[model samples]
Target: MQLALPGFEDYDRVCEGLQEKATKELIASYTDGREMNPSAVFICKTMINLSRNFDILNAKGRDTSRVMAQLLSWFQELEDKLPRASELKPEVAALLGEAKA
Candidate 1:
């Protein structure tokens, strides 16, 4: 059930090779302290966006399921550093709103 393509595997390997501080620095570049998952909020945001656009991706001949599986794996891997939501609809709306800016 591993859906990663070759290039993605390479990318993940490279990310894994980074030092802890470097990884934290990289994640910090995409977020400020206000975020729930300041260390990996981008992954959470990406998961939301990807799930929202699965139809568009499928229309474009992309493997939507495979991509979704990958996103799910990443989400799980970073679960501890990812945000939580009591009400997902509002969270998704907020995410969409942020995208407009």
Candidate 2:
């Protein structure tokens, strides 16, 4: 069941559109070069953050399943470009650790 509200079909697009080089680098840095699914990792991280704020006024418990599907699609579309991402970007490792609360 798609939960995308009107005009919101692009949510997954934006989420998945996070730069491939950046996303893969971030994953590599965090995972220490272990191969991992970039889309799954990105979506999981985004959803984790989203879950924290879901009850906020603007978030209003938006349907996350729909968003996840979109992200996955984006990831699949970009899968081929992920291989060389490790050497192409360094900023991916610069993000602060996730909140520990």
Candidate 3:
């Protein structure tokens, strides 16, 4: 989910993209008539993915620290790409934990 958030520029657009896929039927089922802006949509997608992926990892017996490390590495790569990103906010760098201070 964290990976997907940083990879996508427009959350709503990403949701719309998912609408065409049968795999996303569960998600699309709830989005109907909802007024989800980009950020909210992004957060929702992120949370869903996080829960789903963590479940998979937990089932596979992966450790918590390993999961955190993987997520952090993904965020770091996203930070590296932001300066050159075509659609993501330049200010997104400020959202990172390491950049907060």
Best by TM-score: 1
TM-score of 2: 0.26
- True-vs-predicted CA distance for residue 14, candidate 3, Å: 22
* Residue 13, model 1, lDDT: 41
Model 2 C-alpha lDDT per residue in residues 1-101, reported as the tens digit of each score: 57888999767545332333354554445455445576646654664343333323225545556545554555454444344445544564333223322
Give one digit per residue, the lDDT tens place, for model 1 in 1-101.
46887768655344232223333454455334435644465665565455545545755677677766865676566655544443357968689679888
Residue 12 accuracy (lDDT) in model 3: 40
Error of 2 at 49 (Å): 13
Ranking by TM-score: 1, 3, 2
lDDT of 2: 0.48
The runs of at least 3 residues in candidate 1 whose Cα sits more than 4 Å from the true structure, single-residue gaps closed, are 1-35, 59-62, 82-101
Candidate 2 RMSD to the real structure:
15.0
Model 3 vs. true fold: TM: 0.31
Model-by-model lDDT, in order?
A: 0.54, 0.48, 0.47
Number of backbone collisions per candidate: 0, 0, 0
